[model samples]
Target: MPLYYYYFGVLNATLLFRTARWRPPLLSRHAARGCGHAPSYGKMAARALVQYVVLRGDLRREPLSWPLGALVAQACHAALAVTHAHYQHPDTAAYLDQGGSMRTVVLEAPDESALTTLAETLQQNSIDHKMWIEQPENIATCIVLRPYPKEEVHHHLKKFKLLK
Candidate 1:
């Protein structure tokens, strides 16, 4: 026998699915609703993982006119570093398993101070991340949080805007 609880809105849908006690029932209902049958239970882990990258916007102006690609490289470095550091963790493994579906949200920070402040906040909250410091020149470029279920970290990032 299975239990069913119905609630409207996206948050309710997530709550209904994420409760460990009710996960399988949600999966069955998901397929019944034509979400397409998942080949394995792992495929039904609908947590929606994400890695957030915050790059310093000052790099784009005045004294330093780094091209867009160069700034992007900073984000890439941080993301790869953090992912590698946490490769053995469950969420990280699930994110990598997502392959083509992996999601990364890049946002712009005002300057070094802002990036540093945000890093401190994450540290205080026990959120692990990699803050990439450009070598040779040795400048803090960007920070990347290891893959996490969006809801776990979205509130900390709500203030940032997507990088344009």
Candidate 2:
């Protein structure tokens, strides 16, 4: 009988009964026109927007040996910076509007040189991204691209493996 349970129960009942006639405001236009069920993964994947984060792997392995938390923070910093820079873009808006469905792929660049090269490629291709340079020390730590249709940017990133 907690307040949240009662409210959730009522909301669930409302949705269950009215699903065919009412759609949640957050659903995409295509979804709103369909049966209440979620879209199939294949269909979703075809148009899915994704943000890509590339972190420098060398920092975790050797000479630099940055702490795990610091690397994570670098990725976070780049992601937020680029998102803010592109907040007005349609893809970015839609990506943010997905709420819990937002997707991000974290990949690894072997070292600072690889990261810099990737950033240069992204820039040459007119892909917008933020490369985070850790302050004071001026070390380039990570790069995060704004949300884009997966197909549009995948080729530029296919060579990089996911950060394990």
Clashing pairs in 1: none
Candidate 2, residue 3: Cα displacement in angstroms equals 6.4
Which candidate has the top score in lDDT? 2
* Candidate 1, position 21, lDDT: 61
- Model 1 per-residue lDDT tens digits across residues 1-164: 23444557422334445566643443455446664432254652667889899998889998887899988888888888898898767677666655456789999887899999999999999998999999999899899999888999999988888877
lDDT of 2 at 20: 61
Clashing pairs in 2: none
Cα lDDT tens digits, model 2, 54-85, are 99999998788899999999999889999999
* Residue-level error in angstroms, candidate 2, position 15: 11
- Report the Cα RMSD per candidate: 12.0, 6.1
**What is the TM-score (0 to 1) of candidate 1?**
0.72
Over the full model, what C-alpha lDDT does candidate 1 score relative to the true structure?
A: 0.78
